[model samples]
Target: MMTFAVYLIVFSSVGFGSMNINSHYFNKHMEKLLVSRTFGLAGIRNIEDFWIFAEGPMLDSLFPEPGEMDGNIIVGGPRLRQAKVQNNSCEVHSHLKYLQDSCYGHYTISTEDREAFGPGTTSPWVFSHTGSDYYRGLVATYGGGGYHLELPSNKIDALQAIQALRQNNWLTRGTRAVFVDVVVYSVNVDQLLIAKLLVEFPPTGDALPSWFFEVSRTSLFSKSKDYYIFVCAMISMTFNVYFLLLEACRLVYLKLTYFSRFWNYFDLSVSIGSIISLRFGIKNYLFIASTLDKLPDGVDIPSFEILARNGFNVKVTTSIALSLCWLKIFYFLRVGSSTLAKIRVSVWSCVLNSLGFFMVFVLLVFAFTHLAHHVLGPHLHEYSTLGATTTSLLRALLWDFDLEELQRSRPVFGPMILLVYLSLVLTVLWSIPLAIFARSHTDVMSEISRRCNLWDQWKEMVWGQYSYRQGKVTSEEELRLLLEQEGLTDEDMAAVLSRMGVRRGQHVDSHHLRNALGCLQDAEMLPEVAVRWLTDLKQRVDAAGQKMVALTDKVHMTLEVASGDGS
Candidate 1:
């Protein structure tokens, strides 16, 4: 059993890493760059003439000189790689870039990096050393406890991916600045860092400023197989839903459940499992992250074999997800000897439809990821993590994001991204009123249906009672009496009168009474004739009012004469 579980884990992780995640080395390199750039939780900016990245550095000496600051500070695009050593020192490889930096304010360099700096720590610290060589600065912080021997460039790549996904952690700096664990990115002139800060860090038990959330952390280097498998499971579920819907529609159209039977239980097991994987299985094994990298075109290179190894968490999640898909595809599809086979034909087209729907989930994920990266800007991973990547994908679908200040911390087009998202929000908001109207209509219809049944039943009991003169009182008298006995309001009494078009002393034509009673809750439950009986009785009451009044007057006159004779 353990072996089987292990196999599943391995299968899932490997698949997710190789297939779902970008397999190319080039993409990984780009991710390295993206993650680092975004690490400036303080927020960075790119100028037309130059890209200005700002972060709180432990050693200020790492920045480039004034002369080198002009023009493009980075000579070439970043050279991305994993770190060789842990606890890499901090170096601001200025090559002369900080000359005209007007972006940052004076802030204390929180000295907690030593305690928090390391690989896979729950809370990571951005560490540094005052050195000119980017490589030297990198080595001081890479490790299992680190800035693990991963390059800062990799973080940049992660950030780039985040940006590509179109949402971000960017927000404006308010009266209280966002707490950013701005680590110095120490990389060679070739744009490669010897070490990178770990996403998770030790908080060092220090109480950070108000914007502590800005301080990003690293996550475990989990296998991607589970994520991929989970994704496939979701695709399968989406397809299953489509198939069932199609089969149901067909069944309704063709007047048979034969075509729809197969899909009847599609959502019953596989879908439930898929849902489970989506919520927990995938979550346990994989992480979502925000990155600053743009989508790389080619990813063919194999850079790090060790990093490619699947982790346990990655394996199990993937296996379970794939298992869900397999059950739907193979088990359910092949189980024809069972009685449920009768509906196979009806469900076949729907199965095809569901598979097609899976494509939609895939396309949507890609499309939104692309849009997010492009509009949100490239990720600068100075504070990126693997978990955030998955989250960004979800955000694109949900369209709920907040990054206004990060965009505004600097004067740039970054803040404008909110406008696009806000426009979408407005469109959704405008539709809400219509949605509410529809909901109200359904509720009203349902309520009336429930109550109408009771009305219908009551009407049958009273059908001939009034017409036969079996009841001594008229409907109006009954109405008044019912009010006293049945706890009715003046409103209820008024509605009955209004329906008949009858005033207290006046009689209305009985034609409209049936229509009014038909609108009641119990009408459907009663026989059709009962409604007519009430209608006919109302008319008799209106016509007989004068006769009843004369009788009352005669009785009163007799009583007065008797009283006089007795006196």
Candidate 2:
């Protein structure tokens, strides 16, 4: 129990630390860079907007100067790549003077080697005006049209390439879309971040089109792997090993029946998933580092996508394993608590009883979904598709639908259909499952109560037998004090103790007192008629004792007063 508690605490701490680092440091900075009005995708209206965005917030935020000499802040300059289909007929025209004059061909420009293009360069591959290096090769079209440019990390050189593209009217030509991919690696913080912005131009008008931006980040130390992480990992491994061995022993002893219990299955899954998740988490950290190392001069920019996908897998697996681990708490709780056991039983019973009703409910929902789609598909966008209609119907079931919109869509059928659906679902269908659950819960509570009462009765029977066989003893003085507190006079205490053969300073046996009292009652030694008489006698004796004590106190006070007068 202690080990499981420590594991949960450590796991929660690690999860919290990871969330803090990702949300506070990485996500906050990325949001500022991507959502800024001045430089964000939303503000790009003309070709000049691209220049302002690239040179302004993008540079300042993404390509910030290194704080230390050894700081590893590697930046992959944003590349505006336009994908185009390759043409076999363009093979011969590829050597044309102008790339635009020739048929579209696959090629990428290198901004580093300016010497590839000399003065008066007319090669279709080279951008002579910009002095940029051009390499003729196959480029991924990605089902798009236009030329692609790979800009250098140098801000001025990149700007020059952007200017070259602008001067050549590349953006205004047959360009359907331009993709900007940027990668930044902050090794000091072990963070690899990637941002992609897509700019799509309008099909007819010259007006600027909309842009979509996305950012994904993965970190190695987001969970902060300190000494405690190692310690917890070791503890977790030890526990898994111990449980596996214990389960194996149980399986051997109990044979196949051991697997019949649901908790055993839960234990095995949690153990296996935990080990696998831990292994993957470690590999994910190394994979991020390796991917970051290749991003500096790496020709394949899509590697960042692979890194992000792997990081996401690690997170998902870890989450599942952690969730299973936490759920095991319920299994443990039900063992010591009858109420929890009853709750578990009730839930199981409810599920079993409601299975048929659940299927019917699902069928009804789908029927209504189809009806809504057929009726309101043309009039309302919410019911335009089967999936959308289903979602809207479910929302309506939860009282979240726009009643006014529904009424406006089809005045005659809309309100009528909605009324029928709600009436049937809420008034009839919903109540069936509730009634089943309530019945199951009541049955479980009554059954558990009956078992608890039986167990209590058995315990009491055994305790009664044991106490009769071995009677308890109490000191005579203690017994006398107890009787006095119970309003019994001193004479009555002495008589009872003497009748039981217990003298002063001696012990009184409960068996002897019981036997003597039984005998006295049977012989009518202390009669029922004398019970009120004895009670009245005891009350009178107590009153007399109080009066005598008061008189003694008065006598002492009078003596003191007389002494004072004499003096």
**Cα lDDT, all candidates:** 0.37, 0.60
Cα lDDT tens digits for candidate 2, 1-567: 887787777665544433335434654456566555566765765556765775566555655555623332436566665432222323444566464453333322211112222223333233223221221221221332224456777667776766665665554333334566666655556555655565544333232333322233454444545545656665666766777787789889999998899988998888787777667656766876776576556545556655555566666777887899899999779876756766777889888668888787888888998899999998886897798898888888888888798888888899888888888877657689779888999987777565445444433542353365444336777667655654656676667566667778886555655554454432214432235434565699999999999999999999999999999
TM-score of every prediction relative to native: 0.24, 0.56
> 1-567, model 1: which lDDT tens digit per residue?
343244335434434543322223323433334343343312332211011232222111223446644221221122222222112122334664465322222111321224432233322123333211221121123222111111133434434532322232221110011111222221321111121222211212111111111111123234464356545555544554554566567657867555455444553444344444444434433422222121143211111111122222334454665665445544444453432442343344245445554565456445544554554433422113333434654563465554654364434644454455445444444454444445545555565565465465555543433344434444465545643453445665576556556567543333435555555433233433334444555578977997899989999999999999999
Predicted structure 2: lDDT = 0.60
Highest TM-score against the true fold, candidate: 2
- The residue pairs found clashing in candidate 2 are none
Residue 520, candidate 2: Cα error in Å is 35
Clashes of each: 136, 0
- C-alpha positional error of residue 333 in candidate 1 after TM-score superposition, expressed in Å: 28
Question: What TM-score would you give candidate 2 relative to the actual structure?
Answer: 0.56
